[model samples]
Target: MDCNYIRGADLSHDSELNQKALAYHADPKPGKIAIRITKPFMTQSDLSLAYSPGVAAPCLEIRKNPDDVYRYTSKGNLVAVISNGTAVLGLGNLGALASKPVMEGKAILFKKFSDLDAYDIEVDETDIERFCDTVAAIAPTFGGINLEDIKAPECFEIERRLVERLDIPVMHDDQHGTAVISLAGIMNGCHITGRSMENLKVVIIGAGAAAISCARIYRFMGVKEIYMSDSKGLIHAGRNDLNPQKREFAASEGMTQKEAFENADVVVGLSAPGSFSLEEIALMAPNPIIFTLANPVPELFPEEVRAVRADAIIATGRSDYPNQVNNVLGFPFIFRGAMDVRAKTINMEMKVAASRALAALTQCEIPPYLEELYGTKLEFGKEYIIPKPFDKRLIVEVSASVAEAAVKSGVARIETFDLEAYRHTLAERLA
Candidate 1:
């Protein structure tokens, strides 16, 4: 008998990080997430109540009144992280099975950061209709659906169809998560520079999902002058070969790449590294806000940007840097609030509310522990424009803000919505 026997035990992968990651995933029971029973089943009575006799009572009650399902089951706290592997991180289209690890990681974040139970659903279909239908079919199983990592244009339609068809919260985290967090930083940056949202001229280096969503959310924040560039450069009226999403953000007068970046107040990079030249980024106005958000590699690094223009405020997707516009700062808590309020949809109002809530947290007194944890003094400055993901107050403040917006926007489904009481309940999750 072999003591260390396991499937593919002899097989190995290359690189130091690969080995460490492989062993970490394999030795930790093959996955990053697992489900746990919230109910007791220690005896025959417990079994009868959990399954056979007592379970029937809640089932009948739910059948009699459809909304009773939220009262009787875990659906109110459960979110499905659904994805098609078309655009899984920086590694594109690795297919459904390959995206499982990412989905599981997302589920774990949902649990650890916001106390939400999540199941990762990797759909094997890419056809927009089939994908949407599959997600819609399983929609009833979750209180909310977080659409993830599907390629753009298609993801837009998929989310649209599901949000229209289902009576639950639906959000494409790839789209709105970055949007929400980035907007928070933008809000703080503008305040620091004394720039008004309506007067800001924004240039986006990618026309993908996140960039489009950022443009949409910034519009809600009253940012009017937005120019987006795909692989073809600035999305402008002269381009006959533009998709609807790209066309919507197009500038009426086609401008040169230099013209687009020149005097721009903000620039966001959602594409790969070197998506724009240093000279291009250098063309921005004085004290410009630059977010090079491409993961693993940004369009331009902080040092590079600083060398060219020291006054420019910079943000990246990397955690090692200051003012990281991470999605973790948005999704879990956003869903937590939305589900608690039984929101019909995660509307623009809720998103803007969450962004403002996050921006506000940076100005609040920093927790003593965070300064010690990060080995740096944290405050509302150029270096600390957004709250850290581990901040205990996030689940309380962000969730409460989203809930209030949900209620005020007329999207909440529950009766007697109490914002103060809901804030208390959310705070207990940290306690």
Candidate 2:
């Protein structure tokens, strides 16, 4: 027998950091997430009770009464990350098979970060109503529904209809999740830079899910002066071909995007790569806040934008940058809070509360763990406007605020508890 065998793998002899990295990479298989038996040490009697004969009692009861599934099965702890492959990130529409990697990653993040058991559902159908019906029918299996990467306009209606049909919290993560984080970041950015939301004139590039949602959130925050644009220039109130989503956030009667940005206090770029130029961004008011949240490549590069306006506060979606308005800062924690109180739906009240919580965390005094991770104390300023995604305070501070909002808004199924005590428990768990 010809076999090439290693006698000993001395991984521990390597440098500590290298050993740690290697161990993490080698410990799990290619895709680390999978199902395993929860009650592994069951005896034959336990197996009979859990499986064949004794299990039939609950099964018969659940068959008679449908709502008992949440009591007997894992339905209450599970979420479905459903997607139709029309708008899959920067690499648009790779179909269901290719989109599985992203869906799987989302599932892992949901499980890892929020302690929610998530399963990815990639549908191949192109018809929006069919897909919506299919998902709505299967909604009983999950506590919540996280819709992802379905194309816009259609996505808006689909989400609306699903929420109407299902009793569970139905959200399109690409739309609502991105919007929640962007609003949170924007609130922090404005507060840090000493700008008032009511007086700020903002311009949003791209009238897609993220941009439209951001505009709506801003409007809900009482910022009336906002403008948005798409490929065909500004989405004004009178645009003949404007979709309903874009039309709701359209610019005033006679203003283009560039015109709105000419004296704007904030310019948010949710459009495609290289969409905003230095000259265009330079047209904004003094010390303007700019969030170029396009992934992989921002609408304007941070260094390039900084060259034009040195005092401007800048943020992006990439982790390499200082202020990353990444969805990681919001989604996991938002879902955590939502699930905790058994929220029937994600309403505007909950979203605004989450944003306020995130903003408040940044404005509050910096904690020791934050100082350690960031290598210094965080303050409300140009460079340190938002909390980093890895900040330990998120689960405690943000989730508690969100849960409180859920209770106050009357969407919570469970009774609310002491906010301080809840935060303390969350702090320990996160720590």
The list of candidate 2 runs beyond 4 A from truth reads: 1-28, 60-68, 374-377, 415-421, 428-431
Using TM-score, give the best candidate's number: 1
Candidate 1, residues 1-431, lDDT tens digits: the string is: 00111112212323565679789989948999877888997999999999998899999999999999989899999999999888777556768888899899899999998899999999999899999889999998999999998878788999899999999999999899999999999999999999999999999888878888999999988988998888777889999988898888889665876788999999988887677888987789999999998765677889999999899889999887999999999999999999999999999999999999999998999989989989998878888898998898999999999989999999998888877888889888868
Against the true structure, what is every candidate's RMSD?
A: 6.1, 8.5
Distance from true position, residue 45, model 1, in Å?
1.4
> Ten consecutive residues with minimal summed lDDT in candidate 2?
1-10
Clashing pairs in 1: none
Provide the clashing-pair count of each candidate structure. Answer: 0, 0
In the range 237-344, model 2's lDDT, one tens digit per residue, is 777888777778766677766687897888888766666678888898988898997665577879999999998999988777777887767777777777667888
Model 2 scores a TM of: 0.88
